[model samples]
Target: MQKRKHWNLGAKLAVAAAPFALLALLSISLTLWVSWQLDGGAAAVNEAGRMRMQAYRMSLLVAAGERTLLPDARSEFERSLALLSHGDPERPLFMPRDEDIRSRFDAVGQHWRQYSKHWLDVRPADNRGLREETARFTGRIDALVAGIEAHMSRWTALLNLMQLATMALAVIGATVLLYIGYLFVLEPVGQLKQALERIQQGDLGTRVERNSSDEFGTLADGFNDMADQIQAMYRNLEAKVSAKTAELQEKRERLEALYEVTSLIATARSLEELARGFVGYVARAVHADGVALRWSDEANRRYVLIASQGLPAYMTDGERCLRADECHCGAPNAPPFARVIPIQALEKEGLQYCSEAGFETLVSVPVRLKDRLMGEVDLFFHAEVDLSPSARSLLEALATHLASGMENLRLNALQHEAAVSQERNFLANELHDSIAQSLAFMKMQVEMMRTSLSAHDETGTRAVLDELDAGLRESTGDVRELLLHFRTRTNSEDIEAALQATLRKFEHQSGVRTTLTLREQGLPLPPDLQIQVLHIVQEALSNVRKHARAGHVWLDVQQQPQWRIEVRDDGRGFETGDGPPDETHVGLHIMQERAARIGARIEVFSTPGKGTSVVLTLPASDPTLLDLPPLQAVS
Candidate 1:
């Protein structure tokens, strides 16, 4: 059989009733006993008073010579008085008293005096003494009565006082018992209830005070223990939740960083721009000095610096190229502050060589596009700093992003190069088809006219033939000029030679005088860049021939730290505006585009009725331009 669980009501009622029941029973029993003692004391006092009066009476009778008052009676009376006098009011009446026996002796003396007084009438001389004794006896009887009255009064007063004290004590005891029950039991129970309510409301830290070693103290101790356990459990749970939240936050940050890097790399336009952005990102993410990108030039047998940030200006602009075997990027013998690494390997050998140089520590990542090695990236930092794993991981991710961006940039460059080549090819074909055909047809017509003039009999026939021959010669010169323009494609051609040739052709075709000016010599230019400069010159010449109705033209090509080409014509010039026209003249637009492609600037100056002057300026290439690899050559 399953044991039944006790109800809370039953348990609480038992606890509440047990102490009260015990106290009530004890109080009632004590009260009853005390009342009985009081009653017995009152009865004993009454009996003792009566016995004292009887003893006084017997002693008086004995003084008066009254034989009716027996000795036995007197002794019995004295014994009763002694019992009353000796017994405690609060105790059972059972003991004797010597004071009661002395009262009996006084009664006997009073009785003897009374007898003498009675005999005084019969005897003459002896009667006088007897009469005095009788008077004394009367006084003794009165004193005995007074003593008996005083004993009775004292006994009654003591009984009354005891009864009153017992009643008052019982009332005080009941009140104290009620107060103790209320404080220890009811008040504590109420406090416990409040504590339980707080605990139910999730106040796990709430606890009760244990004031005593009683049951309530035990209960309070148990409550405190339970609260402590609950608090500990909650704290542990909170710790776990906080830890999980932190981990999630870390993961979210990583994802966000990854997304940012991806977006940045995907939208970057140029290597320099990409490098600048990459360095900022890595420096902020990993707390590094800066980032640098270098590429290997196979044709020149050197590694060329492409982009850098946070490096000295001299290092960035100085000899950026280095031989493969002589690279100082990761060399121990290099400056301690330098951070150098080979990002991509040209051949099968891995890493080429990596060095921190003057930097304390460095991380390198190879920028590879479509599995082909493109270049290397180096991240530098001070020696005292250490990169966290998360930061390092982020940097690696950034490196990957840079690699993809670099690949896209290279692809775009290739596409642009292909498009330019195609345009050049189309232009060449058009020139050959249009101008060459027109010149050929004009030549045929002029020849036919010459033949017809030779057959005529008129005197102006020679003059007509001569005019036809001059027209044919002019047409032939125009075709030759067009072909010469086509031959000046490569930048390697001498600038002075190309300019002189174009001006001479222009003079012959346009019937204009042209002068060539050279301010400096040995203008070294990279082949591709020089091609762009030559094109700008070509566009300027074309504009002058078509628009400038000038009789004489001046062409000046100056070379110093910068390349400046100026073409001026003494023709009717148009009004100067914000910039050259965008659509009405495609030549100017083409010239601007060419200048932009080679990182040059173009300026046009013109006034109404005055000559138009076109100027093109380009930053001078390194003096050792020829010693470097071709821009398109893979290194």
Candidate 2:
């Protein structure tokens, strides 16, 4: 394995370049110091040369002593020379006695002294000698001054050339240092920065590679090693994740199989059918020898085997009584095989059963609805099989679903039966009140006419005629009442409106008083129940009119959580023990049947001198029942 270079290359490069940067700064300082010293030397020489020229000019003026010369000339010349003795004065003429320049300055001063003496002596001589001598000496002094000026100009040009060369060298050195920094430092750091950015972006494949055997190279090597390790770890993690994912997929399929079995049971229409299907599915799913289902019928207080499959005939068909301690499947100390199992204890005790049933192990699940024990499902295996936790959970879930479905089905059957009975009662009332009564009245009228005609003589014919007319009127009224009864038989008519119309017609026809009272409103009774209620009212009113022969009828239709209809008559009444006339007692029987169909009870009250009152009380309509078509009157 290669040694890893985990350190950053850019940071290493910066560390390595720090000494070179310091060296470059030191070189720059040395060059500046040397140039400054050279400049100072050149400036001193120039200032000294300028002072020499001034001294020579003043000496010539004093030697000539022309009338233009003032007495202040000597003083001014001494002051100018004194400036050279002060430290770093206005002139650069500080030459020591040992210097070659000091010897030249002494020789120049001796020559000027000689010229001054000669000129001063001749100034008092003849005019011609003075003029000639002064001209010659002045020409000599001007030539010497010109030679000194030429020497100083040459020296100044040399100093300027040295300074320019030093500046050029400093500029070139700085440029070289900058280029080196960019190549070795900035360029490598930029590459390292880009590599780090790629790593941050999740490109673990990035590797740093520097050619030199420096700190940067070590960093590159480390980076490559780290990337390699990370890649290896990532691959290993992927393999482990793949294995776990496959395991989860297998578990999901198993759970789906369990869900399918439960769904099949839920859709089964009857308990027997549902249990048969459930057992078959479970047997296949769990590979059981057989499955059995038993339930406790609360009303009968007996445990019955409602369904079974792949089981012995004795186990399914035989009548069995369940004890809290005994196994119904002929197993010893086996799981409790009752409709209500101790769900919480099923896992710990694993079900108490007898081993004699030739099964090594059995699992029993209780079916409960709203805390009531409705049934149990039992599966028997030939030998103990290792059932997984998921399998046990699925079984429990299925049991819960089965419990709810069974309860719902039971309620549905009861409601259907009640609806059928209500329909039958409604039909009976329509037949008796409308069709039967119409036929009976027609028969009575025809017989009466026949009897009168048979008894008639020619003179007594008018009397018979009057009797026939009265009977015909009564028959017509009966027929009209029958028609009205048929028209109102349908329960869909607003019950209150229908009852009011019926009473109004009765009052109009018989010239009797009628009143209706209602209590509670907005009760949505089912059509069948409504029709049964309507018939009860109609029958009570009919009996009142025919038997009680009451002058006034008070019909009260009331609603609460329960439905009730009561009809009272004020007329000659009979004893409660007195039955309806033998030929016409069907009305009372019809009324009782109608009340029973809607889960209602009817009561009748009467006395010899008081009126008759019939009351019908019924269970209220269940709002959740399925809607049915409106009833149509038979007519």
Q: What is the lDDT of residue 403 in candidate 2?
A: 77
lDDT of 2 by residue, 75-189 (tens): 4534433432332424333323233444454444465456445543245443445445545544543443444445555555655665665566567656765776676666667
The lDDT of each candidate is 0.61, 0.61
For residue 36, give model 2's deviation from the true position in Å.
1.8
TM-score of every candidate: 0.36, 0.50
The TM-score that candidate 2 achieves is 0.50
Tens digit per residue, CA lDDT, model 1, 38-128: 4554556466556546645654555466655545665676466455545656456532233753574346454643453454213333324
**Candidate 2 at residue 332, lDDT?**
25
Per-candidate clashes, comma-separated: 30, 20
